[model samples]
Target: MSTVKQLIPHDQALLVTGSLNAMEDDRGHDDRSLIHPVQIVLDGDVINCSCFDSLGELGVSALVVVQKDPLVTYITTGADLIELSIENDGSAQVRRIEIPALKDVHEMSLLDGVLWLANTGYDEAVAIDLDEKCVVKRIVLGKFRGKIRASLPSFTGNDIQAVDRYHCNQVFQDINGKLCALVHHTSGKQLLKRIARKVIKSQGDGGVVDLDTGQAVSLSLKGPHSVRCVNGDYWVCDSGSRMLNVYDATWRLKNRLPTHGWGRGADFSKHHGLYYVGISAERKRYRDRPDYNDRNLIEVFKTDDGELLGEIPIVDGIEQINNVYLLQRGVVETLLGLKLSSWV
Candidate 1:
């Protein structure tokens, strides 16, 4: 058994991993490289594991475990939605659902049998019927409304105008059972200002947005992602500041731990006592930062105090990590050499 497996409790069955660019190449320009962007069964300690090797195209982002018997992962590949099912025998099945209205889909979450997509390219959070695979309704991200018109080619009547102003990327059901999201930035102008060096941290505008009531509360975050409600408190990856911001149940900032890399994926397991976080590689866009030399990796931290526990570096073949999830053994299973795992 590998060190990672040994460190993790034996009760843990599998590990789910997602990467933005699977290949160790120039990701911004290369799109043809169909490297396996998702990995399963972390059987080794050196970050070397068996993974599904193909998913059509790259730019793969978020992953979620919807149902287990035959393990299922709803993954986002750019604007595409992929359903990968892994069975008990390790065979696999892949289904490509056509969502004409989807534009630049990002981190998603399944709630109440509905899949909520963070349509970043459209500046909206859309809910789709799980059974019909068709869009049911979409809530325009409040900040982006009136800023730009929706121009998505597949966007029909009643759909919000497509204009990416806030760059909303993650959507999930809060602990209160309300829909919420983590917007990358509050305004495109603020984003541009940061790129232009006119500001220091884009005003730390990327905060939590209440999708249900169309209200937003600023937590003074910078380039945040992976906003999740755990144990009734909100934990978010403040990516720009390289920190994890934890808020109390009443939405008060309680803890801000300095994570030593560009933080992205943030998740907590039912196993308790720890949190899993994905620290991405410092690519060209991050060339100006001090940790630009840091390798893409995932770190385990103490959930109570945000103290670092361990890390898994993506050196063997992978490059950039987009998300990380904890899978309980026998909950969901994946094949050895396939991205299309069986729905066992």
Candidate 2:
């Protein structure tokens, strides 16, 4: 068994989000009763788990730590954005905001108080105002009449159509402070062709697109998930190929580190010179496959040399890891606050 000390410092903790295997529905539909919403915290040798049953089966996907002073965290389900506020006195509050027309929200980032979400189901990226708690802009990624719209005017759920052509799963801010997307398909033309043929497949040809420039900065990726800019370098999770691809400041390929599983959620700890990457089990589509029971874990790597340091196994009931975030032990203890006793 791998120990947490091998993965991170004793004063650091990791926040993980995923689906519980036993609570998942066999049919793949979002059944509220079958969904178990929980937050898993790995601190020291203790695994702290908290269940938010009141969230009503929204199904957790991606999350971001938006604030540190008050310790605020935002989580996304397909249908809602849940905000968690932790007070210094060890009390926490939860708020759920309804976001219509959001489908398969995979990853999100916060910039200038606006939360940007990769709305995968609708083939668009959405910007939600943190203060107003509402969507402020929608950047359409799919082709309408063979052309991609710069932005959609509609805001309601029923106003737009669901195409999911590009499978835009992760949204982040580049090193130059530009908003970008990690799409599962290479180009708009390829996506349109697949839609026309009714054959949707995730090939190892996805790329990163600059939302502002309307151009692809990097290409030829396999099922990419998380993209993080660290000290001017771009580190991407090439999940489809089970590798972590690093790029220089010029977006040139620098290194490819093997993750040994389906790479998805990831975060970096500059304080420790390490990278925490989530390696999840293959999805339910591969239920009968030989690797279906593969171990789910967080692989730690040395950022300086791209060395595989160690891994922290995700045990208990969680089967799928959607995101992994590193936090200081002080902030984590404050977030858990009064709830730590009941959770641990």
Query: Which candidate comes out best when scored by lDDT?
Result: 2
The global C-alpha lDDT for each of the candidates, from Candidate 1 onward, is: 0.64, 0.71
| Model 1, C-alpha of 146: deviation from truth (Å) | 6.7
lDDT of model 2, residue 310:
81
Show the lowest summed lDDT stretch of 10 residues, model 1. Answer: 150-159
Name the candidate that leads on TM-score.
2
lDDT tens readout by residue for model 2, 1-344: 34676677777788776664433443344545543444445544535444443342444677778888788888776556788878766577777777888777888888777899999888788999988989899988753323333221222322233334577887777777778788876455333223443433435557777776667643577678888887679898888788999999788999999877889889998877899898977656567866454677888888899988788877644557788888778766665443522211
Give a tens-digit lDDT track for model 1, residues 1-344.
12455445555533444444543444544544434565543544433234444443554666678877777767776677878777777777778777776776767888888888888788788887867878888877755454432222222233233333677888877777777777765443342222243323233666666776556666666678888777777888888788888898767999987776778776677456767788876666567865565576667777767777776665534456676777664553343434424322
- TM match of model 1 to true structure: 0.80
Task: Tell me model 2's lDDT, rounded to 2 decimals.
Answer: 0.71
Supply the global lDDT for candidate 1.
0.64
List the pairs of residues colliding in candidate 2: none
